[model samples]
Target: YVAPNDSFSRGVKYRIDTDKMEIEQLWQYGKERGKEFYSPYICNVTYYNEGHYLTHSGGIAYDSEGNASTELGPFAKLEDPNTVLKSITVETVNDEVALELEVNSNFYRANKFTLYAKEEGMSDLELGQGQLLGTLGETNQMDTEIPAEETGEIVSDWHEAHLTEEVDMLTFQAKFEPGTLAMLVLEGEEETRQYFISTSKGLRGAMCTGTFLPEDDRDTRTVVTKDGLDGEYKVKLIVNDKKFETGLSIRA
Candidate 1:
């Protein structure tokens, strides 16, 4: 629909049923400089299943009421029509897991990142061993990666996830004892934690840390932790269930 600067133009709304797309055009009264006229243009375009799998366009602008689908900044200046995602890096330091993630959005949009983890012998992914430790905001060029472990008690800041997306960036420091052909389980009904395992001398055990998605099928696996010091080995996870087999040791 195109409205003339001097006259009114009747516009029509069209719906594409096969693609499940809807487009609307409406007429509005406005002044162009010193001239009075009616303007006809696409007022709104609503795509079906917008929240599920499809993406739509609305000129880049932030919504005051807070909506995720809305553009983060002035939509007209968006570099790409499709969404652009930032990059992330994960590493181990001082018996802790560190994460450096970047988000490239026009505006500060509420965001979440999820990392899944598993040990050598496990049947699923587990979040119990991976704790959320900290977060750093968006960065340019390179993101700042810091140690996930602290000298004090683990804080609650890094423990929440929206559905399958873990809300935090930092993962906790979880140490595992050494043993081969071991079946380690997390404290949840969802089978998590059956992933790759490695050891370092200073920590005196195996370490696994990263973000985890709570919903997924469990994959069985085996893990090896480091061996013997004279003390009882008790393992604790954020979720339910007791895991790990007895007698995990590394032979000299």
Candidate 2:
């Protein structure tokens, strides 16, 4: 057991030695010399089927009417992890920009990919076809070579029909700026799809895409670019569509 008020305490570890058991106190910084410590006090203890335990205290609350309540416990709930696009790099060469995306999910497979650019002031409901810069087929190679100025880690070992494959890379020529929104639509086998949009990276002329979404009732999501034109735009992954809708922004 660990004391809640003991800031120096790290945790507790138990060792079973035949018929004898030893309890060791773990500290963040080894052990203190001639220092006093508080005893472990029970607050709120929770147990899990996985043989794990969590203890928390002082999280309860009461209203004016004397009704007591407490926040959700640590093991109360769980959510599915979001699919991530990692190590995304955007580069500018000559007059064209290149995009490199690596899917971090081992279960989701992406085959077809498309990109669209929209103006800042456009209405959320009006997710026009924007500009269908281009699309990459089932292959992992791009038609045009990505110039050295815009090249990052290469995607290799892409096998057809394999769920866990290499990156999907594509390039296009377009002029975008701060407040401009860019959307990436990725299609996979059997209607498995994902969407992402550009967002501000809190830097001047240095934006990158992430998983940010706009608050609109429509199935479409949007994000505005931060201040940067370094070919990098922030984007947010919105939803995982299993129907593979044709429209740019529609209900999943």
Candidate 3:
């Protein structure tokens, strides 16, 4: 059966094969006023005998020609899960140095990892020699609330509202040391890409969001830092025990 609607230029096509006990459906949206538009679509398949169902939903941006131009799927597939290091930045928060790492991954579960720092030419795997900066995935969750004083004044006492917006962050604790090359190593799993920390200023105290994982439909930000180190340094991200390397530099 096919049902067409002109309200928003949308239509649905559905078919049923009773002999095979199978059902199929397709939903589509067409362009409006010779302009592009965004449409959300869903598809579902069910096997009545086996009582199994599979569903998929996403938003698509259609061009003027009624063709899908972009797919914004909200689901993650873990068959070959991987991580991408989006960016590394260093900033000072309240006189404390902070190193922020923006990462994207396809894994729902948090991976155990540790941060290490050593002299530029030193080996990152030398456990005894390399400084253990901090550890993550040891705790299930962490929460941090920014006090009202740090945020601003209360705007309404009766309504219990504040003038400045208070920020609450989910975070994990990590020690950051300045003046050394920083490296993050996953405990058991090999990384798909290597990340190197290079900056003009040294690192200080670091915090990360604990509950957020790569599969949470968003990017995860991890920050680390130490105090009192500044200057330019070339950092290399080595993957597979130096099999590949990417370089970047940070200025303060």
Candidate 4:
């Protein structure tokens, strides 16, 4: 979960200076203080008052011999028998530890919320309510030209593909072979778009959410946003050198 240039983990607090137009560091954790205060992934800090704060170090991982592991813990735990997961939460007041908690598990982040309003005791409406609308980004292009041999064949029956539309994206789910070159092509009236599908992932730095992770490693849940798309289009697929029609069409 760590980048090469930004190894290790830490929490920092900054104070903005309105007049000087500069920021000053109020306090920090997990710097030269060593590995005891470090977590490679899944940790956070919560601020309450001027001098009180809560911090969570939720991704401490260790190997069989109890040595710190460079590999991410969640996947390592599933693969290795001796992988250990640890989570720690601490509260500080006036830069001094006031409360501490430790757990034998992993969490992405620790959050503290108030349940009732100050006066009317109205419930917090936003609790347990959330939605995510992802933005569209650039798509990768195929290296070679589109194959000419269509075979007039539809997608293979074993592929088991299902397309679902959302607010601004369409998700295509299908099973594919690992390390295979697969592409999803959308042929529109005025334009055509080709997007690559990842058949396999080598290493995972983190698994913050499993919404799109398939139970089978070879299964892929590819999402294509409708940001730049319009009109109607026929859906097609390319597996290796074979091009196949999907008998699918969409209006964006």
Number of the top TM-score candidate: 4
- Model 2 TM-score? 0.16
Superposed model 2: Cα runs more than 4 Å off: 1-14, 28-252
Tens digits of per-residue lDDT for model 4 on 1-252? 553224445667999999999999988755643455557778999889887888888887777876676666666676675877777778888878898888877778887766566766465455575776576764455565566457679989888887897767788888898988788889998988888888976655457442223456888877887777889989888888888898888887
- Model 2 clash count equals 17
Candidate 3: global Cα-lDDT?
A: 0.26
Overall lDDT per candidate, in order of appearance: 0.25, 0.25, 0.26, 0.75
Residue 140, model 2: lDDT of 27
**TM-score for each predicted model, relative to the true structure:** 0.14, 0.16, 0.18, 0.55
Error of 3 at 107 (Å): 18
Candidate 3 residues 73-187, lDDT tens each?
Answer: 2221121122111111122233232332223321121221246556686545553554555433221212321111111222112211111111211121122233333332111
Displacement of residue 170 (Cα, Å) in model 3 is 3.3
Regions of model 1 farther than 4 Å from truth: 1-81, 84-103, 107-170, 173-238, 244-252
lDDT of 2 by residue, 1-252 (tens): 332223221122344565556554321111230111111121222332222333222122222232221211111111112221222122223213233233321111122223444767543556456554544433222233222221222212220011111123332212223343333333333332222333334432311211222222122322222111123222112212211122222221
Task: For residues 189-238, write the lDDT of model 1, one tens digit per residue.
Answer: 33223322222223212111101111111211122232211222222222
What candidate 3 gets wrong by more than 4 Å, as runs, is 1-57, 62-169, 172-220, 223-252
lDDT of 2: 0.25
Error of 2 at 134 (Å): 20
Per-prediction backbone clash count: 32, 17, 6, 0
